[model samples]
Target: MQLQKKSKKISAIAQNKNLSIQFSLDGFSFCITDLTTNDVNLFSEYIFEKTIASPELLLEKIMYIFANDKDLQQDFKSVSAIHQNNLATIVPNDFFDRNNLVPYLKYSVKTLATDFITYDNLSSINANTVYIPYVNINNYLFQNFGEFEYMHHASVLIDKLITKIKNSSIKTGFFVNVAPNLMDIIIIENDKLSMYNSFSYSCKEDFIYYILFTAEQLQMNPEEFQLTFLGKIESDSDLYKITYNYIRNINFIESTTCFFNEDDDFSNHSNYILLS
Candidate 1:
């Protein structure tokens, strides 16, 4: 279902704005930015009390937000949606084929003949991010707003972290992006992506198990490597508290360094992808 609203008549000057949305079955959040001044016009997240069981419901929730959130019902120079799900994996440039998409994801994730497959190029690492975009969600957004760019949230998360790794003195470390129901663990070594994976957790025990397990697989020492936290997390949150107990030399990505933060209420390290 689509939201009912009159077409917003944006003046020619309105093109200097952009909308960024990141969503999954767990939650939905969006932000609007004034490109001319590099300022954020608005940012809001619609929390889901429990995980939505189906795509139809998720789409309905998004449509409801678009109908009520006055900030979302505006014109923009561009709109980009980030699909946050574990149905994504990375492929080295040498093995990537434009003619075939299913083979890349077949082993990593179960795919059907009907699943719509797409990829995002990771030029920074000479690879491509392959995954399933929300075809239904894309159709809905396209139906209302016309053509807009979209990609897996992992694509944005990995690429942005790569830039940070290259510029930092530290090379090898773990970067964990925590959201409502899932977390992505990205391992970097010598300024290159060593590993990238995402996990779903329902409790603190499950959360720390994934991180500790990943570290064990890589033989990474808890006391040596510095870990950086990002996305919807705080120093006192259960996730951070548990992580700090297991990992040493932990820190957050400063908000001042974040390009998309203009609101005092927004956490410096939260929503790293949407604000990017």
Candidate 2:
């Protein structure tokens, strides 16, 4: 892998000591704040120089965060891990069987001995089964943090997007969330989740291809339905340019949830997944 930019970090003073941690294969991010007042004390985003494919490497990064930020080592009011691996699937809530999660993911992802089966129930649609391939890292989290919640990245975004659609008048819309090397495409119609899936892309063309093809397969007119973008994308980016050229009604989503501080540098669309 070619060398990329280093991580980004930001912090603020806090009135109380509450912490939330979220991380993925591409980055680790956390926010420390007072839940009562919603005052964020510290927020940081660390973009890994290379893709983390092993549990050992993931542990090293987690250890590095704890070593550098002594505050994270202390007890917090809450702690949560938003696993962001692309190996996820959404099954209808009524038909979901926890015991059969592995078979569903096996067809899409390679079986790994360390992969743990976890699921997050959507607000009104389906359950997302995520194959989190970080067994040793999860063990370390359990040993250190006693009891913490685990959520898939897609689940968080889906939850937020569902809320947005319900509150808005738009009857149909597609949300395309872009990450470093991943793209999560979600389709919503009649105020319900129609489809949700993630795809890997190596270039701008590949990224736009998936979006256009998915819309075509769904028989959704790109020019008719509104397409909202989230996650790591910028209006000036090639990914955005290519997508805009192919789709007419494309716009970036604004952050409405009070997850980040007003002073935080996290972008509305770029950091949506991490900050959600």
Question: Number of clashes in every candidate structure?
Answer: 0, 1
Per-residue lDDT of candidate 1, residues 155-197 (tens digit): 9988888887788787686888988788999998887889999
How far is 166's C-alpha from truth in model 2 (Å)?
0.7
User: Which 10 successive residues of model 2 have the least lDDT summed?
Assistant: 1-10
lDDT of 2 by residue, 87-107 (tens): 778877677787777777888
lDDT of each: 0.81, 0.75
Top candidate when judged by TM-score against the true structure: 1
**Residue-pair clash count for candidate 1:** 0
* True-vs-predicted CA distance for residue 45, candidate 1, Å: 1.2
- The TM-score of candidate 2 is 0.88
> TM-score, each model?
0.89, 0.88
The residue pairs in collision within model 1 are none
